[model samples]
Target: MKRREALEKKKSIEELIKNANDPLKDHLNSLPCSYRHYNRNGLSVYLESGIGSNLSSFKKQYIQKLLKVNMEAAYGPKEWVFEEKVKRKEMVAPDARYVFVREIVDNEDGMQPPGDSFVGFLQYRFVLEEEMPVAYVYELQLEQCVQGKGLGKFLMQLVERIAYEYRMSAVMLTVQKGNVFAMDFYVSQLRFVVSSNSPSRMGFNTSYEILYKAVDCEAKEK
Candidate 1:
């Protein structure tokens, strides 16, 4: 009964945060504005944050295409189903938040750059998971051109910081067993562990596993 009450309190906390006009603003204010700009490995890019519903049509299409391509490559065409996996409603749900990485383009004329400049994006939401408040990563997709430049780790670290600031218990995400690179990145490099609620642990023969990193010491102990 005490555990149930605690879980309810956590859910309420998450709802309050998600209902804010700018959920990430307070958590991000302490960071320098330049933190959004990435310049390394001869690659320059900028980051922007917004709720999924705010994504422009161009950006929406870009995200769908990028996610489709990446998932297909990982799962193969035989396992890929567009409607089942790439649902637009889920991607653009009001509660879904995004951190977009766009290439830096020079326009001395002071006009917006032509065409899409997006290179990658991370989508996440604050929710109750395993009776704990958690930041759940729905997707992290990057263009092939920008892969292996440490951007993925940088983005995830940002997510962890934000989650910590928001008092979330942990950062959680799902990874497909077929995506060996991603599994290694999360498990080996980032040190995320398989969650106790993962399908494999529950005796379910699923193709994917749920992994998480505890953000709070209390959560780690639990």
Candidate 2:
């Protein structure tokens, strides 16, 4: 009787676990989209987009799912509870990092808005050495709605434009094969040169490609 009872209990727990996963899967599939626009004057910059309060929740859920374990399993029981607080600390509004809402201008007047607005953005990190400036795009995100509308290309070109103004010697970025659309865009549309020699540190196992566009920003003007 004891053995039979234990088997029934195990079956009930399995059913519960399966049922709980369905809703979470659906939530991820239908994540919401919030778009904005941005611009920086002359200097290369990181553009943040996709802002909303739910960004925190999204990150927590994403980390949980990626581990494929409940919070307790991932961080251990007591540790997990405390770790939740740390996770909240790491939370950022999706758009806070990339939005340039301050640049928007009101149609009623020539005045710019108090902050920049971005529909999507590419984040360029520029490093200056001596007289040379090299910029790398650490992140790029397209508003889900604005994606597939050529906004990605427009945003990328905007980065190069900023690099030109900053007198950057070169601009570069990396794209993994899983994101084939981005790879194609960088190679074909922007005319970025793909590096054949070195593998990427982060995506070593994947078909990650590094690309760069050299700018003779210091070249003497004729």
Q: Whose TM-score is greatest here?
A: 1
lDDT of 1 by residue, 17-55 (tens): 564335446334646676687888878888878677777
After superposition on all C-alphas, the RMSD of every candidate to the true structure, in Å, is 2.9, 21.2
Q: How close is candidate 1 to the true structure, as a TM-score?
A: 0.87
Model 2 Cα shift for residue 217 (angstroms): 8.3
lDDT against the true structure, per candidate, is: 0.82, 0.48
Off by over 4 Å in 1: 1-30, 82-86, 109-115
How does candidate 2 score on lDDT? 0.48
Residue 72's lDDT within candidate 1 is: 72
lDDT for position 92 in model 1: 80
Best by the lDDT measure: 1
